[model samples]
Target chain A: MYAIDIKDIKKIYKGGVEALKGISLQVKKGDFYALLGPNGAGKSTLIGIISSLVNKTSGKISVFGYDLESQLEQAKAKIGLVPQEFNFNQFEPPLQILVNQAGYYGIKRQEALIRAEKYLKQLDLWGKRDQPSRELSGGMKRRLMIARALMHEPCLLILDEPTAGVDIEVRRTMWAFLTELNKQGVTIILTTHYLEEAEMLCRNIGIIDKGCLVENTSMKSLLARLETETFIFDVDPPTHLPSSEFFSIKQVDEVTLEIELDKNQSLNKVFAELSAQGVRVNSMRNKANRLEELFIGLVEKGSKNV
Target chain B: MFNHNYFIALKSIWRKEINRFLRIWVQTLVPPVITMSLYFVIFGNLIGARIGEMNGFDYMSFIVPGLIMMSVITNSYSNVASSFFSAKFQRNVEELLVAPVPNYVIILGYIGGGVTRGLMVGFMVTCVSLFFVDLQIFNIFVLILSVICTSILFSIGGLLNAIFAKTFDDISIIPTFVLTPLTYLGGVFYSINLLPDFWQAVSHFNPVFYMINAFRYGFLGIADVSLIWSFSVIIAFIVALYTLVAVLLSKGIGIRS
Candidate 1:
C-alpha cells in the first residue's frame, strides 16, 4: 500500500473558487518525495486535507491503507504535518508543547517526556525548553515546530514550506536532520520554494501548476530532460573569437561570451577548439542555477498550456 | 486508535485550558471575586439593611443565592468564550484539529475547562458570603445540581458563540446586549412578587429567574417557582446546547477551512 494515496480530489471554496481541480497523487512507503509548485498551487490545501485540518469537497485519501473518511483518527495517527505557518500556542513552553502534542497521539506522560527531551536536545532546543515560545528567535521557533511534529514518531511526515525563511546555516542543519529521519524508513513529503533543496533531498518528484500535476517522475529523469545548458566564459583577449565546433556562441562584451553546449558534448571539446583558435580561456560558469532555470521553465510552460 | 487516544487527548486539552487561565489569574480569578465582593457590600449589606425582609427571610440572606448563581453563570460563559475564540484567532486550534482526537472529545475537554472555572468562582463567592450572612442549605442536592447544570449549559452557549464569532467584538456582543440584561431582570435584586402583574408575567419569560429562584429555594426552603419545573428547564437547555455544539464541531463548520 502507498504511504499516501490521494484520488481525484476537488476543493471549491465558499465563493466558488476551485482551488483543486481533480488532482490525484500517490507516494510509496519510505520514499522521500517532493511536491513542487509556485504560490497558489494547492500544495497547502492538499496537506491540510490529509491532516484533517481542511475539509475537501470531494476525494478519497488514505494513509498507510487506512481510509481518511472511515478511519480518520487512525489515518491521522500515521501522519505528522508541519504546516507552512507557525500554529502552536505562543504562551506554551517548548517542553510542554512537545509533550502536549505527544499526548494527543496516546503517548503516556513518562514516555512523552522522554520523547520530548530527545527531540528538543536533538534539535538544539533543550537549553531554552523552559522559556515560553514567545521568547524564542525565529530559527528556534521553527525548530520547535519540527520537534512537536516528530513527537509521535509518525510513519509519514508532511512538511509544507518548512524552511521558507531562515539563514542558510540553519536551513542546512534542518536538511541534515530531515535526511536522517528519512534514512530511518520514515516516508516524507516536502513542499518548498527552494528548487535546489528538492533536487538535493528528494528521489521522486511531482510538479503542480494551477491545480494540475504537470510532471511526476524520478529526480534523475526530471533533471535528464535538459537538452542543452548555457555557459558563460571569460576570455583573456576581449575581441578574440573561439572556433565553433558544436556550440552556438554569442559575445556578451569584450571579455564575456555566452555559449549553449549540447548535453552530448564535453567541456574538453570547447577547450580544444578554443586552443586551436589561440583564444585564451580565463574562467567559466553556468548562466543560471540548473534546477531554478528548469523549474521556471516548467511552471511557465504549464501556465501557457492553461 | 481514536478510542485509544480519546482520553489522552482530552487530558491534554483540559490541562492546557486550565493552565491558560491560571497563568493569568489576575484577569480570570481575581476580577470575579472582587466583583462579587462589591455586590455583597452594596446590595447585601447596606441596601438590605433598609429593605428589612423578603419572602419571609432576612434581605441579606435572600439575595445571596442570586449573587452566587450570577457569578457561576458569567464565569462559565466567559471562560469558554474567551479561551476558544482566542484559540481560533491565534490559529492554535489547528493543534487539536490536526490531531487524532474525536470531535466529541474536543468538545468535552473544552466544556470541562469552562465548568471548572464556574465552579471555582461559585465556591469562592460562597466562601466570601460567610462574612455577610449566616447561610443555611435547604437542599444540598438541588443546590449542587442547579450550579453544575447551569454552568454546563452556559459553557455550551459560550462554545456556540465562539464557533460563530469572527472577531473579538462578536464574542462580547451577546453578553453585553442579551446576557447582562437577562441576568439583571432575572430576579437577582428583587423577587418577581414585587413587580406589577404584567411585569411579573414578563419576568417569568426570563430563564435566569428560574435558575436563581431554584437555587434560592435550595438555600431558604422557599421559591416562587416549582422545583421540578426549574430542574426540567435546566436539563432541557443543557441537552439542547450540548447536542448543537457536538454537531457543529463534527461538521467542522467554523474551525476548519
Candidate 2:
C-alpha cells in the first residue's frame, strides 16, 4: 500500500475560498517525495487534510491503507506532521512538549521519556530540553518540531516547509538527519521552497499550482524534460568571443562567459569551439539550479494554460 | 479507542493542564484564594456582625457554603476556559487534533484538570472559612456530591465557552457579564426568602442559585431549594453542556479549519 493515497480531495474554506481543487496523488512506501508548490498553492492545506488538522470538503484520503474517514485514529497513528509554523506551546520546555505529544499517541510516560531523550539528543537539543521553547533559536524550534513529530516513531512523516528559514549549516544537518531517518524505512513527504534541497533529497516529485497537481513524476524523468540549459563559464581573458551557431555564448565580463545550450547541443562541442577561439575555459557551472528552472517553467506553463 | 492507549492520552492531557496551572500557581491558584479570603473578611465577618442570624444560623456560618461554592465555580470555569483557549490561541491544540485521541477524551482530560483546580481551591477556601466560623457537615454524601457535581458542571461550561471563544477578551466576557451577576444573585450571601416574591422567582432561573443552595443544604441542612431539584438541574446541565462540547469538538468549530 502507498504511504499516502489522496483521491480527488477538495477543500473550500469558510469564506468560499477554494483552497484545493480536485487533487489526487500518492506517495509510495519508503519513498522521499517532494510536494512542490508556490505560496498559497494549497500545499499546507493538503498536509493539514492528511494530518486531520483541516476538514476536507469532499473526496478521501488514506494513510498506509487506513481510511481517513472511517479509520481516522488508525490512519493518524501511522503519520506525523511538522507544520510550517511553530505550533507548540511556547511556555513549556522541549522535553515536556515531546513527551506530551507521545502521550497523545498513547505512549506511556517512561517510554515517552526515552524516546524524547533519544530525539532531543539526535536533534542537538538535549542541553536546552529544560528551557522554555520560546528561548530556543528559530532553527532550534524547527528541529524541536521535528523531534516532537518523531517521538511516536510513525511510519510516514510529513513535513511542511520544515527548513524554510533555517541557515545553511543547520539546514545541512537537518537534511542529513532526515536522510538517515528515510534510510531507516520511514516514508517522508517534504514540501519545501528550496528547489535544490528537493533536488538533492527527493526521489519522486509532485508540483502543485493553483490548487491543481501540475506535474508528478520521478526526479530523473522530470529533470530530463528541460529543453535548454544555461551554464556560466570562467574562462581566461579573451581578445575576441567564440563564434558558434549550435549554441549562444555571451561575455558576462572579460573572463566570465555565459552559454545557453539546447538539448540537441553537446558541451564537448562548445569546449572545442571555445578552444579554437583561444578562449580556454577554467570552470563551468549551471547559471541557475536545474530543478529551479524546470519548476519555474512548469508553474509558468500551468498559469498560461489556466 | 477506549483502551489503555486512550487512558494514557487522557492522563497526558490532564497532566499537562495540571502542570500548566501549577507552574503559574501565583496567577491561577493564589489569586482566587486571596479573593475568597477578602470575601470572607468583608462579607462574613464585618458584614455579618451588622446582621445577626440568617436562616436560623449565624450569618458568618451561613455564607460559608456559598463562598466555597463560589470559589469552586469560578476557578473551575476559568481554568478550562483560559487553558483551552490558550492552547487554541497558541495553535498547539493541533497537537491533540492530529493525534489519535478521541474528541471525548480531550474533553474529559481538560474537565479533569478544571475539576482538580476547582476542588483544590474549594478545599482551601473551606480551610480559610474555618477561621471565621466553626463549620459542620450536615450530610457527607450530599456535600461531596454537590461539590463534585458543581465543579464538573462549570468545567464543562468553561469548555463550551472556550470552544466558542475567538479571543482572550471573549473568554472573560461571560465571566464578567453573565457569571458574576448570576453568582451574586444566586443566594450566595442571603436566602431567597429574604428577597421579594418576584425576585425570588427570578433567582430560581439562575443556575448558580441551585448549586449554592444544594451545597448549603449539605453544610447547614437548610436549602432554599429542594436537594433533589438542585441535583437534577446540575446533572441535566452537565449532560447538555457535555453533549454540546462533544459536538463542537467533533465539528472542529474554532480549533480547526
Candidate 3:
C-alpha cells in the first residue's frame, strides 16, 4: 500500500497568496522521500497539508489508504510531523511534552510514558528529559521535537527542515537515526535546504518551485539528467588566460579556469586539446556532481523561464 | 472512523496550561489574593465606614461579591491571554496543528485553563474577604453558576484577544484598555442605583455589571438588575462568545498558514 497519496492539492491563504497549486505526489511504504525547493517554493505548504497543519483549498490526500478529509484521525495517526520551527512548549520538560503528545493520540498516560522514555533514549534526549525545552540548545530542542513526533510510532514521518538550525554533529546523528528508522520500515518525508543532506538520505526526490512541482524522480535518475561535469584547470602561468571552444567557460582566472563539460565530452580530451594549444595543464580535477549544484541550476533555470 | 479521542487532546493542552499556572503560583495565584485583600481593607472597611449602608447591609458585605467577580474576570482573562500569547510567541502551537487534536479541543483546553485560574483566584479572594466581614452566601446555586459561567465567557473573550495579538504589547492592550474600563464601570464599588438616569442606562450596557450583580445577588439576595435578567444575559454572552471562538479556531485565524 502507498504510504501517502496526494492529488491536486491546492492552498491559498486569506491574503489570496496561492501557496500550493494542483500539487500531487505519492510515497511508497518505506520510501525516504526528500522534497527540495527554495524559500517560498511551497515545500512546507505541501508538508503542512498532508500533516493537516494547513487546510487545502482543493484536493485529496490519503495516508496508508485512509482518506484524510473523511478519516483525519486515522490519517493523522499514521503520520508524524516535525515542523520547521522550534515550536514545542518551552516551559515544559522534554519528557512531559513527549508524553503529552502521545496522550493527544489517545494513548494512556502509562503507555505514553513508556514510549516517551524509549524515544527520548533513542534520540539521545533521555538525560535531558527533565529540562525545560527552552533551556536545551537548538539541536537538542530539534531532537526533542523529532522524539515527540515518534512517540506514537507513526508509519510516515514528515520532517520540515529538521536540520536547518542544527549543528553539524547533531545533523549527522539525526540523519543516522532517521536512516535507521527508515530501514526499520518507516517511510520518511523530509524538506531541507541542504541538498547534500537530501541526496545522502533520500532515495526519491521532488523539486518544487513557485508553488509547483518541477521534477520528481529517483535520485539516480535526477543526477543523471545533469549534462555538465565541472572541471577546474590549473595552469603554470599565474596571469595566463586560456580560450577553449571545447567547453562552456564559467570562470577564467589568472591561474585556473572553471568549465562545464558534457557527460559525452571527456575532461581528458579537453586537457589534451589545451596541451595542443601550447598551454601547460599543471593539475586537472573533475568535480563530482552534487545535489546543490543541480538544485541551483534547476531552480535558477525554472525561475528564469517563469 | 470518528476518533473520540479529542478528550485526549484536551488533556495534553490542559496539563500544559495547568503546569504553567501552577509553576508560577506566586505570580499567578498569590497576587490576586493580595490585591483583593487590599481592596477589602481600603474599599470595604476604611472607606466603607464613611459610605455607610445602602442595600440593608454593611458596606463591606455589599462589595465582597463584586471584588470576587473582579478577581474571577481578571484571572480568567489574563490566564488565557498570557498562555495563548506565550504559545504564539514561542510558535509552539504548531504541535497541536500537526496532531490529531481538533481545533475545538484546543479552544476548550485553553479556555479550561483560564476558567481554572479564574475560579482558583476567585476562591482565594473569597476566603480573604471573610476575614474582614461576616460573609453570607444567600443563594448558593446562583452564585456558583454565575461565577463559573462568567469565568468561561471572559476566558473565551481572552482567547479571541490572544489570537489577534501580534506581540507581548498586544496581549496587554486589551486587558488594559477594554477589560479594565468595563470592569471598573461594572459596578464593583457602587450600585447602579447611585448613578443618575442616563449613567444607570449606560451601566446596564456593561456585561460585567450583569455578571457582578448576579453574583452579588447570590451573596446578599439583592441585585441592581433583575436576577432573571442577569442570569439570561450571562448565559447568552457565554453562548455567543463560544460560537465566535469556535469559528475563529476552526479557521486557524492567526495560528495556521
Among these predictions, the greatest lDDT belongs to 2
Model with the higher lDDT, candidate 1 or 3:
1
Measured with C-alpha atoms, the lDDT of residue A216 in candidate 3 is 90
Q: What is the per-residue lDDT of model 2 for residues A1-306, given as tens digits with 9 covering 90 to 100?
A: 999999999999989999899999999999999999999999999999999999899999999999999999999999989999999999999999999999999999999999999999999999999999999999999999999999999999999999989999999999999999999999999999999999999999999999999999999999999899999999999998777888888889999999999988899999999998888889999999999999999999999998
Q: What TM-score should be assigned to candidate 2?
A: 0.97
TM-score of each: 0.95, 0.97, 0.91
DockQ result, candidate 1: 0.77
Q: Please tell me what DockQ candidate 3 reaches.
A: 0.59
Model 1, C-alpha of A196: deviation from truth (Å) = 0.6
Tens digit of per-residue lDDT, candidate 3, span A42-68: 988888888877888999998999999
In candidate 3, stretches whose alpha carbon ends up further than 4 angstroms from where it belongs are A14-16, A231-261, A264-289, B1-4
Evaluate candidate 2 by giving its C-alpha RMSD to the native, one decimal.
Answer: 1.5
Q: How well does candidate 3 score on lDDT at residue B233?
A: 88
Better of 1 and 2 by TM-score: 2
Clashing pairs in 2: none
RMSD of each: 2.0, 1.5, 3.0
iRMS per model, in Å, is 1.1, 0.5, 1.8
Per-residue lDDT tens digits for candidate 1, residues B1-257, read 34656888889888888888888889998999999999999988898899999988889899999999999999899999999999999888888888888888888888899999999989999999999999999999989988888888888889999999999999999899988998989998889999999999998788888899889988989888899988888888888888988889899988988
DockQ of each: 0.77, 0.89, 0.59
